[model samples]
Target: MLNTWYYSDAPRTVRPMLSVMRRQSGFAEIIGDIDQENATFEARRCLSCGNCFECDNCYGVCPDNAIRKLGPGNRFEFKYDYCKGCGLCPSECPCGAIMMIPEEI
Candidate 1:
Protein backbone atom coordinates (compact mmCIF):
# COMPACT_ATOMS: atom_id res chain seq x y z
CA MET A 1 0.00 0.00 0.00
CA LEU A 2 1.18 3.54 -0.74
CA ASN A 3 1.10 6.46 1.62
CA THR A 4 -1.21 8.80 -0.26
CA TRP A 5 -0.23 11.69 1.97
CA TYR A 6 3.40 11.37 0.93
CA TYR A 7 3.29 9.46 -2.36
CA SER A 8 1.23 10.23 -5.43
CA ASP A 9 1.04 7.83 -8.36
CA ALA A 10 -0.68 10.25 -10.69
CA PRO A 11 0.80 13.35 -12.29
CA ARG A 12 0.66 16.53 -10.24
CA THR A 13 -2.33 18.78 -10.89
CA VAL A 14 -1.58 22.12 -12.54
CA ARG A 15 -2.78 25.28 -10.83
CA PRO A 16 -3.45 27.90 -13.52
CA MET A 17 -4.57 30.40 -10.91
CA LEU A 18 -1.16 30.24 -9.22
CA SER A 19 0.20 32.39 -12.07
CA VAL A 20 -2.17 35.18 -11.12
CA MET A 21 -1.15 34.74 -7.50
CA ARG A 22 2.50 34.88 -8.48
CA ARG A 23 1.94 38.05 -10.51
CA GLN A 24 0.34 39.69 -7.50
CA SER A 25 2.99 38.52 -5.02
CA GLY A 26 5.99 38.86 -7.34
CA PHE A 27 8.88 36.37 -7.33
CA ALA A 28 11.13 35.95 -4.34
CA GLU A 29 13.79 33.53 -3.21
CA ILE A 30 12.31 31.27 -0.55
CA ILE A 31 15.24 30.27 1.61
CA GLY A 32 15.21 26.70 2.88
CA ASP A 33 15.85 25.60 6.42
CA ILE A 34 19.50 25.56 7.47
CA ASP A 35 19.20 23.12 10.37
CA GLN A 36 20.83 19.71 9.93
CA GLU A 37 17.76 17.63 10.85
CA ASN A 38 15.55 19.85 8.74
CA ALA A 39 18.05 19.59 5.89
CA THR A 40 18.04 15.79 6.21
CA PHE A 41 14.26 15.78 6.17
CA GLU A 42 14.29 17.86 3.00
CA ALA A 43 16.94 15.59 1.48
CA ARG A 44 14.49 12.70 1.67
CA ARG A 45 12.50 14.52 -1.00
CA CYS A 46 15.33 13.94 -3.49
CA LEU A 47 14.87 11.34 -6.21
CA SER A 48 18.07 9.52 -5.12
CA CYS A 49 18.71 7.82 -8.44
CA GLY A 50 21.28 5.01 -8.18
CA ASN A 51 20.83 5.64 -4.47
CA CYS A 52 18.06 4.94 -2.00
CA PHE A 53 15.99 6.47 0.80
CA GLU A 54 14.27 3.17 1.81
CA CYS A 55 10.85 4.38 0.69
CA ASP A 56 10.23 0.63 0.00
CA ASN A 57 7.74 1.11 -2.82
CA CYS A 58 9.90 -1.12 -5.01
CA TYR A 59 10.52 -3.74 -2.39
CA GLY A 60 6.86 -3.77 -1.50
CA VAL A 61 5.51 -3.95 -5.04
CA CYS A 62 7.87 -6.39 -6.80
CA PRO A 63 5.96 -9.54 -7.70
CA ASP A 64 9.06 -11.65 -8.31
CA ASN A 65 10.90 -10.63 -5.15
CA ALA A 66 13.76 -9.33 -7.28
CA ILE A 67 14.32 -6.20 -5.22
CA ARG A 68 16.19 -6.90 -2.02
CA LYS A 69 16.06 -4.71 1.06
CA LEU A 70 19.49 -4.24 2.62
CA GLY A 71 18.15 -2.60 5.78
CA PRO A 72 18.09 1.10 6.50
CA GLY A 73 20.64 3.38 4.78
CA ASN A 74 22.03 0.42 2.78
CA ARG A 75 19.56 0.80 -0.12
CA PHE A 76 18.30 -2.00 -2.36
CA GLU A 77 19.85 -4.42 -4.86
CA PHE A 78 18.36 -6.08 -7.93
CA LYS A 79 18.45 -9.85 -7.65
CA TYR A 80 18.91 -10.78 -11.28
CA ASP A 81 18.59 -14.43 -10.38
CA TYR A 82 14.91 -13.93 -9.62
CA CYS A 83 14.12 -10.79 -11.58
CA LYS A 84 11.79 -11.11 -14.59
CA GLY A 85 12.37 -7.62 -16.04
CA CYS A 86 8.69 -6.73 -15.64
CA GLY A 87 9.49 -2.98 -15.77
CA LEU A 88 7.12 -2.40 -12.86
CA CYS A 89 9.70 -0.87 -10.51
CA PRO A 90 10.63 1.93 -12.84
CA SER A 91 7.03 2.44 -13.81
CA GLU A 92 5.81 2.80 -10.26
CA CYS A 93 8.68 5.02 -9.19
CA PRO A 94 7.27 8.35 -7.94
CA CYS A 95 10.47 10.37 -8.14
CA GLY A 96 11.35 9.46 -11.78
CA ALA A 97 14.65 8.18 -10.44
CA ILE A 98 14.71 4.76 -12.08
CA MET A 99 15.19 4.33 -15.80
CA MET A 100 15.16 1.28 -18.09
CA ILE A 101 17.99 0.45 -20.47
CA PRO A 102 18.37 -2.27 -23.05
CA GLU A 103 20.78 -5.05 -22.26
CA GLU A 104 23.95 -5.27 -24.37
CA ILE A 105 24.13 -8.31 -26.56
Candidate 2:
Protein backbone atom coordinates (compact mmCIF):
# COMPACT_ATOMS: atom_id res chain seq x y z
CA MET A 1 0.00 0.00 0.00
CA LEU A 2 1.12 3.55 -0.73
CA ASN A 3 1.13 6.28 1.90
CA THR A 4 0.99 10.01 1.15
CA TRP A 5 1.38 12.97 3.46
CA TYR A 6 0.20 16.47 2.66
CA TYR A 7 -0.69 19.77 4.34
CA SER A 8 -4.20 21.06 4.81
CA ASP A 9 -5.55 24.54 5.42
CA ALA A 10 -6.81 23.63 8.88
CA PRO A 11 -3.53 22.86 10.56
CA ARG A 12 -0.65 20.40 10.85
CA THR A 13 0.43 17.87 8.22
CA VAL A 14 -1.86 14.99 7.26
CA ARG A 15 -0.91 11.47 6.25
CA PRO A 16 -3.16 9.40 4.01
CA MET A 17 -2.54 5.75 3.38
CA LEU A 18 -4.15 3.21 1.12
CA SER A 19 -6.15 0.33 2.56
CA VAL A 20 -4.38 -2.88 3.54
CA MET A 21 -6.32 -5.06 1.11
CA ARG A 22 -5.31 -3.03 -1.96
CA ARG A 23 -1.95 -3.55 -3.68
CA GLN A 24 -1.63 -0.27 -5.55
CA SER A 25 -3.09 3.21 -5.52
CA GLY A 26 -5.06 5.02 -8.21
CA PHE A 27 -6.43 8.57 -8.39
CA ALA A 28 -9.04 7.84 -5.73
CA GLU A 29 -6.36 6.17 -3.68
CA ILE A 30 -4.37 9.39 -3.72
CA ILE A 31 -7.27 11.56 -2.59
CA GLY A 32 -8.40 9.03 -0.05
CA ASP A 33 -5.00 8.35 1.41
CA ILE A 34 -5.64 10.21 4.65
CA ASP A 35 -6.27 7.70 7.43
CA GLN A 36 -7.33 4.98 5.02
CA GLU A 37 -9.25 3.04 7.63
CA ASN A 38 -10.95 6.14 8.98
CA ALA A 39 -11.60 7.55 5.53
CA THR A 40 -13.15 4.33 4.34
CA PHE A 41 -15.17 4.26 7.52
CA GLU A 42 -16.35 7.80 6.92
CA ALA A 43 -17.05 7.20 3.23
CA ARG A 44 -19.80 4.83 4.25
CA ARG A 45 -21.21 7.56 6.48
CA CYS A 46 -23.20 9.15 3.71
CA LEU A 47 -27.02 9.14 4.02
CA SER A 48 -27.49 8.93 0.24
CA CYS A 49 -30.40 11.37 0.66
CA GLY A 50 -32.31 9.98 -2.31
CA ASN A 51 -29.66 11.14 -4.74
CA CYS A 52 -29.44 10.15 -8.40
CA PHE A 53 -26.24 9.20 -10.18
CA GLU A 54 -25.91 11.80 -12.97
CA CYS A 55 -29.41 10.94 -14.00
CA ASP A 56 -29.38 13.41 -16.91
CA ASN A 57 -32.53 15.01 -15.62
CA CYS A 58 -31.22 18.34 -16.84
CA TYR A 59 -30.22 16.91 -20.23
CA GLY A 60 -33.64 15.44 -20.76
CA VAL A 61 -35.51 18.64 -19.82
CA CYS A 62 -33.59 21.36 -21.61
CA PRO A 63 -35.92 23.81 -23.35
CA ASP A 64 -33.41 25.07 -25.94
CA ASN A 65 -32.50 21.50 -26.93
CA ALA A 66 -28.91 22.44 -26.21
CA ILE A 67 -27.96 19.20 -24.51
CA ARG A 68 -26.25 16.57 -26.61
CA LYS A 69 -26.29 12.86 -25.94
CA LEU A 70 -22.93 11.27 -26.51
CA GLY A 71 -21.41 7.90 -25.63
CA PRO A 72 -23.39 4.67 -25.54
CA GLY A 73 -26.97 4.28 -24.39
CA ASN A 74 -25.81 3.63 -20.85
CA ARG A 75 -23.55 6.66 -20.84
CA PHE A 76 -24.98 9.90 -22.24
CA GLU A 77 -23.36 13.27 -22.87
CA PHE A 78 -24.66 16.82 -22.69
CA LYS A 79 -23.60 19.54 -25.15
CA TYR A 80 -24.21 23.20 -24.39
CA ASP A 81 -23.80 24.57 -27.90
CA TYR A 82 -27.22 26.26 -27.88
CA CYS A 83 -27.49 26.67 -24.12
CA LYS A 84 -28.68 30.08 -22.94
CA GLY A 85 -27.31 29.43 -19.45
CA CYS A 86 -30.82 29.17 -18.22
CA GLY A 87 -31.08 27.89 -14.65
CA LEU A 88 -33.97 25.60 -15.44
CA CYS A 89 -32.04 22.35 -15.67
CA PRO A 90 -30.02 23.00 -12.54
CA SER A 91 -33.11 24.06 -10.66
CA GLU A 92 -35.11 21.09 -11.83
CA CYS A 93 -32.58 18.49 -10.70
CA PRO A 94 -34.16 16.71 -7.74
CA CYS A 95 -30.90 15.67 -6.17
CA GLY A 96 -29.13 18.94 -6.92
CA ALA A 97 -27.00 16.91 -9.27
CA ILE A 98 -26.44 19.44 -12.07
CA MET A 99 -24.42 22.54 -11.48
CA MET A 100 -24.14 25.36 -14.02
CA ILE A 101 -20.68 26.75 -14.38
CA PRO A 102 -19.97 29.96 -16.25
CA GLU A 103 -18.65 29.35 -19.75
CA GLU A 104 -15.02 30.16 -20.29
CA ILE A 105 -14.33 33.57 -21.74
Candidate 3:
Protein backbone atom coordinates (compact mmCIF):
# COMPACT_ATOMS: atom_id res chain seq x y z
CA MET A 1 0.00 0.00 0.00
CA LEU A 2 2.58 2.58 -1.03
CA ASN A 3 1.59 6.17 -1.59
CA THR A 4 2.42 7.28 -5.12
CA TRP A 5 2.86 10.91 -4.08
CA TYR A 6 6.47 10.16 -3.14
CA TYR A 7 7.42 9.38 -6.76
CA SER A 8 9.27 11.80 -8.98
CA ASP A 9 7.47 13.41 -11.94
CA ALA A 10 6.98 11.44 -15.17
CA PRO A 11 9.46 12.49 -17.81
CA ARG A 12 8.47 14.62 -20.83
CA THR A 13 6.57 12.63 -23.45
CA VAL A 14 7.84 13.78 -26.85
CA ARG A 15 7.62 11.75 -30.11
CA PRO A 16 10.61 9.48 -29.35
CA MET A 17 10.34 9.94 -25.58
CA LEU A 18 6.84 8.63 -24.81
CA SER A 19 7.90 4.99 -24.50
CA VAL A 20 10.85 5.87 -22.32
CA MET A 21 8.64 7.93 -20.04
CA ARG A 22 6.21 5.03 -19.64
CA ARG A 23 9.01 2.61 -18.89
CA GLN A 24 10.61 4.94 -16.35
CA SER A 25 7.33 5.51 -14.57
CA GLY A 26 6.61 1.79 -14.42
CA PHE A 27 10.03 1.00 -13.04
CA ALA A 28 9.81 3.74 -10.47
CA GLU A 29 6.43 2.47 -9.27
CA ILE A 30 7.67 -1.11 -8.98
CA ILE A 31 10.87 -0.17 -7.15
CA GLY A 32 9.07 2.17 -4.80
CA ASP A 33 6.42 -0.40 -3.94
CA ILE A 34 8.99 -3.13 -3.26
CA ASP A 35 11.08 -0.84 -1.07
CA GLN A 36 8.02 0.24 0.89
CA GLU A 37 7.02 -3.36 1.51
CA ASN A 38 10.52 -4.35 2.63
CA ALA A 39 10.69 -1.42 5.02
CA THR A 40 7.34 -2.39 6.58
CA PHE A 41 8.50 -5.98 7.05
CA GLU A 42 11.80 -4.98 8.63
CA ALA A 43 10.05 -2.64 11.03
CA ARG A 44 7.83 -5.50 12.15
CA ARG A 45 10.80 -7.82 12.77
CA CYS A 46 12.57 -5.74 15.41
CA LEU A 47 12.49 -7.61 18.75
CA SER A 48 13.08 -4.65 21.08
CA CYS A 49 15.53 -6.76 23.09
CA GLY A 50 15.40 -5.95 26.81
CA ASN A 51 18.84 -4.28 26.73
CA CYS A 52 18.84 -0.53 27.27
CA PHE A 53 18.11 1.46 24.16
CA GLU A 54 21.02 3.62 25.30
CA CYS A 55 22.84 0.64 26.67
CA ASP A 56 26.16 2.14 27.76
CA ASN A 57 28.23 -0.71 26.39
CA CYS A 58 30.37 1.83 24.57
CA TYR A 59 30.17 4.44 27.35
CA GLY A 60 31.55 1.96 29.87
CA VAL A 61 34.38 0.75 27.61
CA CYS A 62 35.69 3.98 26.05
CA PRO A 63 39.12 4.72 27.48
CA ASP A 64 39.35 8.24 26.07
CA ASN A 65 36.17 9.76 27.55
CA ALA A 66 35.07 10.23 23.97
CA ILE A 67 31.51 8.96 24.55
CA ARG A 68 29.57 11.14 26.97
CA LYS A 69 26.85 10.06 29.35
CA LEU A 70 23.87 12.27 28.59
CA GLY A 71 21.09 11.58 31.10
CA PRO A 72 19.20 8.89 29.30
CA GLY A 73 15.57 8.21 28.57
CA ASN A 74 16.35 6.39 25.30
CA ARG A 75 19.25 6.55 22.83
CA PHE A 76 22.74 7.29 24.14
CA GLU A 77 24.20 10.54 22.98
CA PHE A 78 27.79 10.51 21.72
CA LYS A 79 29.96 13.54 22.25
CA TYR A 80 31.61 13.55 18.85
CA ASP A 81 32.78 16.84 20.26
CA TYR A 82 35.94 14.83 21.06
CA CYS A 83 35.42 11.26 19.71
CA LYS A 84 38.57 10.03 17.99
CA GLY A 85 36.41 7.26 16.43
CA CYS A 86 38.84 4.67 17.76
CA GLY A 87 36.24 2.00 16.83
CA LEU A 88 36.38 0.60 20.37
CA CYS A 89 32.67 0.91 21.21
CA PRO A 90 31.39 -0.91 18.16
CA SER A 91 33.96 -3.65 18.67
CA GLU A 92 33.15 -4.20 22.33
CA CYS A 93 29.38 -4.47 21.85
CA PRO A 94 28.29 -8.05 22.52
CA CYS A 95 24.99 -7.66 20.68
CA GLY A 96 26.51 -6.05 17.59
CA ALA A 97 25.43 -2.85 19.24
CA ILE A 98 27.07 0.30 17.92
CA MET A 99 28.13 0.96 14.37
CA MET A 100 31.04 3.21 13.48
CA ILE A 101 30.03 5.68 10.86
CA PRO A 102 32.78 7.66 9.13
CA GLU A 103 33.39 11.16 10.37
CA GLU A 104 33.18 13.98 7.84
CA ILE A 105 36.55 14.67 6.23
Candidate 4:
Protein backbone atom coordinates (compact mmCIF):
# COMPACT_ATOMS: atom_id res chain seq x y z
CA MET A 1 0.00 0.00 0.00
CA LEU A 2 1.08 3.54 -0.80
CA ASN A 3 -0.13 6.92 0.40
CA THR A 4 -1.39 9.02 -2.51
CA TRP A 5 -4.22 11.43 -3.07
CA TYR A 6 -5.49 13.30 -6.11
CA TYR A 7 -8.41 15.49 -7.08
CA SER A 8 -9.69 17.23 -10.20
CA ASP A 9 -8.28 20.76 -10.56
CA ALA A 10 -11.01 21.95 -12.94
CA PRO A 11 -13.01 24.90 -11.67
CA ARG A 12 -16.67 24.44 -10.81
CA THR A 13 -19.33 25.52 -13.28
CA VAL A 14 -22.63 27.29 -12.70
CA ARG A 15 -25.88 27.71 -14.58
CA PRO A 16 -26.47 31.18 -15.99
CA MET A 17 -29.27 33.14 -14.39
CA LEU A 18 -30.67 36.56 -15.18
CA SER A 19 -29.06 39.45 -13.43
CA VAL A 20 -30.91 40.93 -10.46
CA MET A 21 -31.40 44.19 -12.32
CA ARG A 22 -33.11 42.52 -15.25
CA ARG A 23 -34.95 39.97 -13.06
CA GLN A 24 -36.69 42.68 -11.10
CA SER A 25 -39.11 42.98 -14.03
CA GLY A 26 -40.78 39.83 -12.61
CA PHE A 27 -41.15 38.30 -16.08
CA ALA A 28 -40.52 34.91 -14.47
CA GLU A 29 -37.92 32.30 -15.51
CA ILE A 30 -34.72 33.85 -14.32
CA ILE A 31 -32.50 30.90 -15.26
CA GLY A 32 -31.35 31.05 -18.85
CA ASP A 33 -31.40 28.03 -21.16
CA ILE A 34 -28.32 25.87 -20.60
CA ASP A 35 -26.48 23.46 -22.87
CA GLN A 36 -26.55 19.71 -22.22
CA GLU A 37 -23.25 19.90 -20.36
CA ASN A 38 -24.46 22.68 -18.09
CA ALA A 39 -27.82 21.05 -17.66
CA THR A 40 -26.15 17.91 -16.37
CA PHE A 41 -23.88 20.02 -14.21
CA GLU A 42 -26.86 21.98 -12.86
CA ALA A 43 -28.84 18.84 -12.09
CA ARG A 44 -25.97 17.70 -9.87
CA ARG A 45 -26.42 20.84 -7.79
CA CYS A 46 -29.81 19.67 -6.49
CA LEU A 47 -28.30 17.68 -3.63
CA SER A 48 -26.34 20.73 -2.54
CA CYS A 49 -29.57 22.58 -1.73
CA GLY A 50 -31.65 19.63 -0.46
CA ASN A 51 -33.85 20.08 -3.55
CA CYS A 52 -36.35 17.42 -4.54
CA PHE A 53 -34.94 14.96 -7.07
CA GLU A 54 -38.33 13.48 -8.05
CA CYS A 55 -37.64 10.25 -6.17
CA ASP A 56 -41.41 9.75 -5.51
CA ASN A 57 -40.85 8.68 -1.93
CA CYS A 58 -43.20 11.24 -0.39
CA TYR A 59 -45.76 10.59 -3.10
CA GLY A 60 -45.93 6.91 -2.21
CA VAL A 61 -45.67 7.41 1.55
CA CYS A 62 -48.45 9.95 1.97
CA PRO A 63 -51.35 8.32 3.75
CA ASP A 64 -53.82 11.11 3.07
CA ASN A 65 -53.06 11.05 -0.62
CA ALA A 66 -52.00 14.64 -0.28
CA ILE A 67 -48.81 14.41 -2.29
CA ARG A 68 -49.51 15.18 -5.92
CA LYS A 69 -47.37 13.51 -8.57
CA LEU A 70 -46.37 16.28 -10.95
CA GLY A 71 -44.95 13.99 -13.63
CA PRO A 72 -41.38 12.87 -14.28
CA GLY A 73 -38.53 15.21 -13.27
CA ASN A 74 -41.13 17.81 -12.16
CA ARG A 75 -41.03 16.81 -8.50
CA PHE A 76 -44.21 16.88 -6.36
CA GLU A 77 -46.66 19.28 -4.80
CA PHE A 78 -48.33 19.11 -1.41
CA LYS A 79 -52.09 19.13 -1.79
CA TYR A 80 -52.91 21.29 1.15
CA ASP A 81 -56.58 20.83 0.29
CA TYR A 82 -56.24 17.23 1.42
CA CYS A 83 -53.08 17.35 3.54
CA LYS A 84 -53.45 17.34 7.30
CA GLY A 85 -49.80 18.14 8.04
CA CYS A 86 -49.16 14.63 9.34
CA GLY A 87 -45.42 15.25 9.10
CA LEU A 88 -45.04 12.08 7.09
CA CYS A 89 -43.59 13.71 3.97
CA PRO A 90 -40.78 15.45 5.78
CA SER A 91 -39.95 12.29 7.68
CA GLU A 92 -40.10 10.05 4.64
CA CYS A 93 -38.04 12.41 2.45
CA PRO A 94 -34.61 10.88 1.80
CA CYS A 95 -33.07 14.19 0.72
CA GLY A 96 -34.67 16.28 3.45
CA ALA A 97 -36.49 18.22 0.75
CA ILE A 98 -39.94 18.18 2.34
CA MET A 99 -40.52 20.59 5.16
CA MET A 100 -43.44 21.22 7.51
CA ILE A 101 -44.47 24.72 8.42
CA PRO A 102 -47.19 25.37 10.97
CA GLU A 103 -50.00 27.61 9.85
CA GLU A 104 -51.24 30.25 12.24
CA ILE A 105 -54.98 30.60 12.53
* Best prediction by lDDT: 4
TM-score of every prediction relative to native: 0.53, 0.40, 0.43, 0.53
Candidates arranged by lDDT, highest first? 4, 1, 3, 2
lDDT agreement with native, every candidate:
0.65, 0.56, 0.58, 0.70
Deviation (Å) of 75 in candidate 2: 4.5
Q: What is the C-alpha RMSD of each candidate to the true structure, in Å?
A: 8.1, 13.6, 14.4, 13.9
Error of 4 at 68 (Å): 1.0
lDDT of 4 by residue, 1-105 (tens): 111121123445765788898899879788777788977765554442366767677888889999888888777777899998888777766667776779999
- How well does model 3 score by local distance difference test? 0.58
Model 2 ranges with Cα > 4 A deviation? 1-51, 54-56, 70-75
Clashing pairs in 1: none
Number of backbone-clashing residue pairs for each candidate, in the order shown: 0, 5, 0, 0
Say which prediction, candidate 1 or candidate 2, comes out ahead on lDDT: 1
- Span of ten consecutive residues with least summed lDDT in model 1: 8-17
State how far residue 43 of model 4 sits from its true place (Å). 9.9
Native-to-model Cα distance after best TM-score fit, residue 30 in candidate 1, in Å: 12
